[model samples]
Target: MAIRLRVLLALGCALLTAGCASGSEMTFRQDKRLTIVSPGTGKTVRLPVKVSWTMRDFTAVRAGSPVRAGTGYYAIFLDKYPMAPGKSLGSLVTNGDCAGVSGCPDAAYLAQHLNVFVTSGTSYTIDAVPSSGTLGSSSHYLTIILVDGAGRRIGDSSWTTSFTVAGAAS
Candidate 1:
């Protein structure tokens, strides 16, 4: 048991050292508040609704998804790290040079169709943690969608806004 513990400790230290030397491939972006869904469950109390949708890289946004002057780009979701070529959609932590995701849990969204109030307020702490390199400092199009636990669209209202990943010049 002691030997095993030492091996694990050494491995963890080695991984951290490697990451520091590799330089950060992520960054931190301001949280763009959005709407979501939540409910009081019997056991879990408040359950958070899952998010769904696709990311339309600004360069590929079609005319239908044109960027309006006043309206900003959409911030679909979090977790865009691709193990190979694709990406994951979830929240993460990071720091300088590290990529920052735009979406957030504790954010206010425009109440259009469904009541945004149903989404119990959450507090997302932006910390320097591991993240999939999905979002970065760039002008792109994002589409935010709300879904139920079973992966079903809840509201008719979705977001298509223009946004910029405020980061250092790359």
Candidate 2:
């Protein structure tokens, strides 16, 4: 009876291992996050403005690398939100957004639709700030989105912050 019980336990352990290997486990990639560390939101700053950030549970790779899960670069948008291709007004999208590390966009397509500054590094410097409207509202929104090396947007990994550009009032 003891031998039979041991055999049953062994079988149970094998089943659990098989379940894990077959992707029956819930993997939480949502914990992967990015945070802007400099130029606090709502703060006024001068140009050539330097923006920096911190990444957790993610890997930043250079452009042109093979599209892979959890590996990508940053696309910095000025006064704009990073939207998936055709979703953007007047966007002549020819490629799709990255979904779960697949269907990544190439650099050219992203540049045409997203209008972003691509970088693998954590920091970037904005040399020029666009002119504010007649209201002289120098406030601007800077957003950062993670994308695969192929330039496709990653899963929900985007952040935005606002700051006034010094001397941006027109």
Candidate 3:
């Protein structure tokens, strides 16, 4: 038993060392890029839904922090992508209503009004969603975008997936 434990420990150490040598905390697949891990496309899910995703070469930072290279938070859009003519969700909330003020829309406003949830983590749990237009279930789109600390989008780093909510009849 002791020898076996030592062997396991040694293997774990070697793997850790290899990962450190690679200089990346996580190993990502080239083709895998940014992808949703659960509640797959076309799958039906329940409320308090858990959504997870994975990305490459990026770090999730807390909102309102100073913008750092390769470090940002995620903006999750449920149903429709909040767009007002040429304005974005962040811009509209910041420059339009709030008038370019810092922390204008805030987190609560985003979730309650716009269905836009923000998080620094890799996963988010949706407590509730809109009712389905049809009977039984409804399809919704989940869009995840990497945004900077100031709530602006970072380049074109965005991913989208569709799923159904069971028992969300209208």
Q: Estimate each model's TM-score.
A: 0.22, 0.63, 0.70
Q: Candidate 3, clashing residue pairs? A: none
Candidate 2, position 119, lDDT: 85
Tens-digit per-residue lDDT, 1-170, candidate 1: 99999999999999888867433665434333443322111112211223322333222221123333322222233322111111111222222222453432222321221122212113222222112223443332233543332222333335443333334243
Where does candidate 1 stray beyond 4 Å? 1-75, 78-137
Error of 2 at 22 (Å): 23
Query: Sort by lDDT, best first: what order?
Result: 3, 2, 1
Report the number of the highest-lDDT candidate. 3
How many backbone clashes does every candidate have? 19, 0, 0
* TM-score for candidate 3, residues paired by index: 0.70
| Model 2 C-alpha lDDT per residue in residues 1-170, reported as the tens digit of each score | 99999999999999888756545555545433788987789888988878999998778899878888889888888776676732322232434344444433444444445555778899988776667622247877888887776666776656888888777755
Compared with the true structure, all predictions reach lDDT values of 0.31, 0.70, 0.76
The lDDT, on a scale of 0 to 1, for candidate 3 is 0.76
